[model samples]
Target: MLLETTPDTSAFMIAGYTVAFVVMGLYVASLFIRNRNLDRDAEMLKTLFEAESSPSSKKEAGKSAKKPAPKKKSVSKKK
Candidate 1:
């Protein structure tokens, strides 16, 4: 009669699970950071749009418009 022995793979299985969980955790953290950045950008854009579309800003821009500069006299070169 012959007896069969089973091989142990518990350590490899544990290592694989640990790596998978760590990768998933990092992915979740990155997504949260991206969402926060998007929120900040959206707020900044809203503020910019509000500034550009306000009546007072338009009036101020029109009032402070720069005048055209005078033309300079050109000197002719002899050929």
Candidate 2:
């Protein structure tokens, strides 16, 4: 009697590889987007820090650094 053999699994293998590559590409794209956003945030923070550290801001900060002395309150005798 003649016996039937199993079919090839190359199609399944190709499909699995396709899925894996797609997932990897998506992950890489997300990483790139995140990096770009972080770069933009860093630039904004740097500019803000520079602005705050400028001479005018420093002068203002110095002027506001001194606090007015607190006055002592007089207490009255209570019954």
Candidate 3:
């Protein structure tokens, strides 16, 4: 009886490698997007905190020395 030779499986191996590279590329891209979003959030929160603190502190400091305006007295002459 003659023996049959098996076909090479290199094509299947190459396809698997391609799929692995594509998946890794996608994962790296997602990580980059998440890092950018976190940086933006941090910058926004810092700005918000500065905006919230400055005006209130100034108003509080002014409150200690500020006086209310004097009211004018009404004069009634017989008309």
Candidate 4:
């Protein structure tokens, strides 16, 4: 009777699973970091927007907008 035995591949399987989990963990961690950064940026932008929309800033913007352009001096042509 000739019987073939199955080869042991458990070690390779474990290694592959470990590598996959590690990569997944790193990806999830990076996503968390990016989400936190985006939230922080959103808050910062909101504050800046509020500051720009304030009455004091509006008055300053209005003053600048109401200014007239300076007259340009023309050069006299010599014949």
- How many Å off is the CA of 12 in candidate 1? 1.4
lDDT of each residue in 20-44, candidate 4, tens digit only: 9999999999997777667666655
lDDT, model 3, position 68: 34
Q: Per-residue lDDT of 4-79 in model 3, one digit per residue for the tens? A: 6777899999999999999999999999777766666665565555555556757766544432322222322212
Off by over 4 Å in 2: 1-3, 6-8, 57-79
Q: Which stretch of 10 consecutive residues in model 3 shows the poorest summed lDDT?
A: 69-78
lDDT of 2: 0.61
Candidate 1's residue-wise lDDT over 15-66, tens digit each? 9999999999999999977776676666556555555455565666643342
For residues 1-79, what per-residue lDDT tens digits would candidate 2 score against the true structure?
2676777999999999999999999999999777766766665565555555555646666444422222222222221
lDDT of candidate 3? Answer: 0.62
Candidate 3 displacement at residue 68 in angstroms: 31
lDDT of 1: 0.60
Order of the predicted models by lDDT, top scorer first = 4, 3, 2, 1
lDDT per model vs. reference: 0.60, 0.61, 0.62, 0.63
What residue runs in model 1 are displaced by over 4 Å at the alpha carbon?
1-5, 56-79
Tell me each candidate's TM-score: 0.58, 0.57, 0.58, 0.59
Best by lDDT: 4
